[model samples]
Target: MKEDIENTSDSLKETRNVFIGAKVTPTQKEHIKSLAGQCGMTVSDYILSRAYNFKPKARLTKEEAALLQNLDDCRSDLVKYISALHGMSTKQRMVMFN
Candidate 1:
């Protein structure tokens, strides 16, 4: 519907222009470049699209939203575990490991 499309469009704010550096192996860069070309999006756009899974016109049902939230929480837990194993302080570490 037109109203849904308009609402979706309004929700997405324009990305700010900023510089962020990433260190990637040559192979990774080449793969990203090739995929970006195939998808007809710039390398940055392609990467961003995959990372955000952005679709201007797509909508999430309530069940999908709940699943997404659960996945996000799992990701957070994984990050905490990785951090604890690396160098994060014991005090800041989560008790889930216990």
Candidate 2:
């Protein structure tokens, strides 16, 4: 179908599926990892962002970091609750709503 073909093309555009490998000294690897940590990104993500000419933002403050962690926990809890809802019968769901 044309729709299926278009969907595949759109998905391909959305993802970077290419792999780039490099050789680096242990010290260099550590430095790159440290920089990535400061940007709150994985080493690979940091490298890719830099390669694409994107500037990495400064690290978050302790309070900001704590808030982000709490937000992540809340998001996880919400996902679990939604998944549980999917297993409920219609009557049970109506009971829940009421």
Question: For model 1, how does the per-residue alpha-carbon lDDT over 65-87 read when each residue is reduced to its tens digit?
Answer: 89999999999999997876778
User: Residues 1-98, candidate 2, lDDT per residue (tens digit)?
Assistant: 75675588678886657789999999999999999999899999899778757899969989998999999999999999999999999999999999
Instruction: Itemize residue pairs with steric clashes in candidate 1.
Output: none
Error of 1 at 78 (Å): 57
How many pairs of residues in model 1 come into backbone collision?
0
TM-score of each: 0.40, 0.47
C-alpha lDDT score of every prediction, in listed order = 0.73, 0.89
What does the lDDT come to for candidate 1?
0.73
